[model samples]
Target: MQGSYKDKEGEEFWEEIHEVSTNFTLFLIFLHIVGVTMSSRLHNENLVKSMVTGKKNLNN
Candidate 1:
């Protein structure tokens, strides 16, 4: 009976895993914002160019 259920370090292990998961989620959110901003800017630029020249840039 010297080493029963109370002799484990489960709490500390779970805490570390939770912290790492939170940090990874935050990083993914940041990357998503950056990508969306860039894509919107590019789309707007192409639209403006097409309006001025009366021709669509199919390469975009």
Candidate 2:
């Protein structure tokens, strides 16, 4: 891999790969954060509804 990047073309290809990987990693991280936040919000909402109604709503 080190030797392959000695040429201009290979270097360009490697840079593109790096950029793509970085973007993909950031996207995954963003998805994970969004999932966690949504789950937490749902849990809190359920808790609040349960407290108000004095019963758990599990139908949905």
Candidate 3:
């Protein structure tokens, strides 16, 4: 986190970027979880299992 004082008005800029990026990442993760839940329920399929197995049963 150490940076020169000239790095855009001291470390405040970096701190702001870090905070926004972290919050954005967490938001994306939350959206992904909600998406997966809705998709699994709608499709009536084990999406996580298919992800781990790398394939899904086409018959279904």
Candidate 4:
């Protein structure tokens, strides 16, 4: 005489989905960092420093 089994199943499914989404988000963050680092190295620019200081040299 309480919540039905179906409700419990649905809750478990949603929990698993939430876990998967969280893991995917973390993976995306890691991928972005790698991409930024590789790009900085390839371009020979201190991208992270510029981003933190909000200053970039203009060669115009």
Candidate 5:
């Protein structure tokens, strides 16, 4: 907050960098959901429940 970018180039630079950052964050979230779903189906487990309880069954 102590400094400001006075040039158009700086604005464009930050915009592009943060755009990639946003996309990467979204991709990570998508992967997390897919991984949880896959684990639930493949292992016969309720992953959401386990997350809530902070425990997983041995059979799972």
Candidate 6:
């Protein structure tokens, strides 16, 4: 690949940035799952199923 940065320091800096961003994104995803699980338990609803089916089960 054609080098975009002028020196090794620049490349290393960007690589670090990429790694940090990727990890942060995964962490955020984990938090999202936790939030969903908590919400499902608190509300006593199958939130994941509803999300997948695009329908909510309502008891009459």
- The top-ranked prediction according to TM-score is 4
Off by over 4 Å in 3: 1-9
Give the TM-score (vs. native) of candidate 5.
0.77
Off by over 4 Å in 4: 58-60
Give the clashing pairs for model 6: none
* lDDT string, candidate 3, 1-60, tens digits: 557568757578889999999999999999998999899889888888899999986766
- Which lDDT tens digits does candidate 2 get at residues 1-60? 555546878789899999999999999999987876687587755654666689876765
Model 3 residue 34 lDDT score: 93
Model 5: per-residue Cα lDDT over 1-60, one tens digit each:
434566666888999999999999999999999999998999899989999999988861
TM-score of 2: 0.63
**TM-scores for candidates 1 onward, in order:** 0.58, 0.63, 0.75, 0.86, 0.77, 0.85
Q: Which number leads on lDDT? A: 6
Using TM-score as the measure, name the better of candidate 3 and candidate 6: 6
Poorest lDDT segment (10 consecutive residues) of candidate 3: 1-10
Residue 6 lDDT in model 5? 64
Which runs of model 5 end up more than 4 angstroms from their true locations? 1-6
Candidate rank order under lDDT: 6, 4, 5, 3, 2, 1
Better of 1 and 2 by lDDT: 2
Residue 24 C-alpha lDDT in model 3: 100
User: In model 1, which range of ten residues has the least summed lDDT?
Assistant: 43-52
How many clashes does the backbone of model 2 have? 0
Question: Against the true structure, what is every candidate's RMSD?
Answer: 8.3, 7.9, 3.9, 1.9, 4.0, 3.4
